[model samples]
Target: MKKDNKCVDINVSANVGECAYSRGSTPIADEGDAVIRVPVELAVLNIRTNLAAKIKFPEPVLEIKDIKKRVQIVQCKLLLPGVAAGTDPFVEGSYHLFIKGYVRKNIQYASPCYNSGVCVNSEMRSLTTDVPFECVVEIAEDDFDRTPQLPFQNARAEFDFFRQQDLGHGYPEKDHFLSSDLSQFHQDSSQFYNQMPYCELISSRITEWDEALDRKPFHNSANWQEGTFETISEKMFLQFTVKVLQNQQVRVTAL
Candidate 1:
């Protein structure tokens, strides 16, 4: 069985936090200076799943050669600024902490069969045991007094765990045909323009016009009429202008 070419897999990890110690000394007149213990609190945060990986086709057809997991840390700050630093005692009170992990499953694509015009479909399996998960923690206003004791909580529900499944295979022949046509058009246009003597000059002038347009934006007209002839050019300048006019007309109709 033939397999599609494999691309390099990149693994990236995000930093969570570092542990640091703070020292404080108290002065005494009669006795020697006394040292006090100042314990640092671990940051607590919360995050929810906003986006999930799309299952290609009706199902996933790729094989999972390996699974990689990582945790991302998000920090939260107080809405009100200008407050004196170190005054906010609890780390949990100052910022919220959230963690999210990504799982990338590596799989090979089966080669297409030329004789029957059918592609050999195979399922992508996940070899990794750890699944991607998210966790969130919120520090209540009353929970701030006890410092040094980090208030870490498991927010993931038991039923919330998810695993990637292999869907069925798909034949992209139609997609390939459309893509080939687009490529041919681009190639022919390039060859024709390359043979033209004033191609460079025309392209340079177009670039200058594009830069000028960027400096001073203009709207495109969606529809226009010169006497009895109505023309609608799909140019950007015309389209923008036409869209504005259409919006105004819609507002007037509503009113």
Candidate 2:
């Protein structure tokens, strides 16, 4: 069905905090040859958005015809320790992060409203809703022995590219990974590193509905003929943590 309005753009704002890193166990191998995966979890305080969509009222009375839903993974980030190469027990404080994902858009609409005897169409409206997110925990390297699981399996491949580039090493040039130098010795704590990190929505969803609305008009108002009504509301939130990459399986060596 043709939509009365469509979302053209979306702006995301979020609050992040509470960051901790843990090490995973390396397989049974030599110290230099074994690989370990670190897990980190950041808390997601609050997430909000601003949307850009267009709508037009062709007639005086128009009811919602349909509803739509769109959910997608927007981005991913990997957290790492502040320790440089060849550090004794690995630095305790400070951290680094690697992010990768696609740019996306979000659109929302309210339930249809009515007027005096006739349904008065709406021009445009804005609304915001609070959502709950899952905060993945940070696991230590040795902990991998019991609970062995890697997060963000869907975006792992792309994240791997960002990992390689950050390591000051070269991955597949044809893959077009983002340019970022995060080598052990040349770490840039100025950019995406955080200590008390919070969880952020890496994926978002847009829901559209034509369901009926509950609204009442004010009779003593200036414009009584044009009644006020509530619009439809739809929301989706995906949360993941940025862990310290203290023990990651390197895909490529620095050149």
lDDT of 1 by residue, 172-227 (tens): 43342221222222221111111100000011000001111111111232222101
Model 1 weakest 10-residue run by lDDT:
239-248
Per-residue CA lDDT of model 2 for 1-255, tens digit only, reads 876583543344544679888974322212444344333332222223333222332222233333333333233343543433223322233222333432232324433344444444344433332322222234345433221212221111122223433323465545544654445233222232222322354444443223324445556545654443344343333333222222333233224
Error of 1 at 154 (Å): 37
Root-mean-square deviation (CA) per prediction: 36.3, 21.9
The top-ranked prediction according to TM-score is 2
CA error at residue 130 for candidate 1, angstroms: 16
TM-score of structure candidate 1: 0.24
Query: What do the candidate models score in CA lDDT, each in turn?
Result: 0.25, 0.34
TM-score of each: 0.24, 0.26
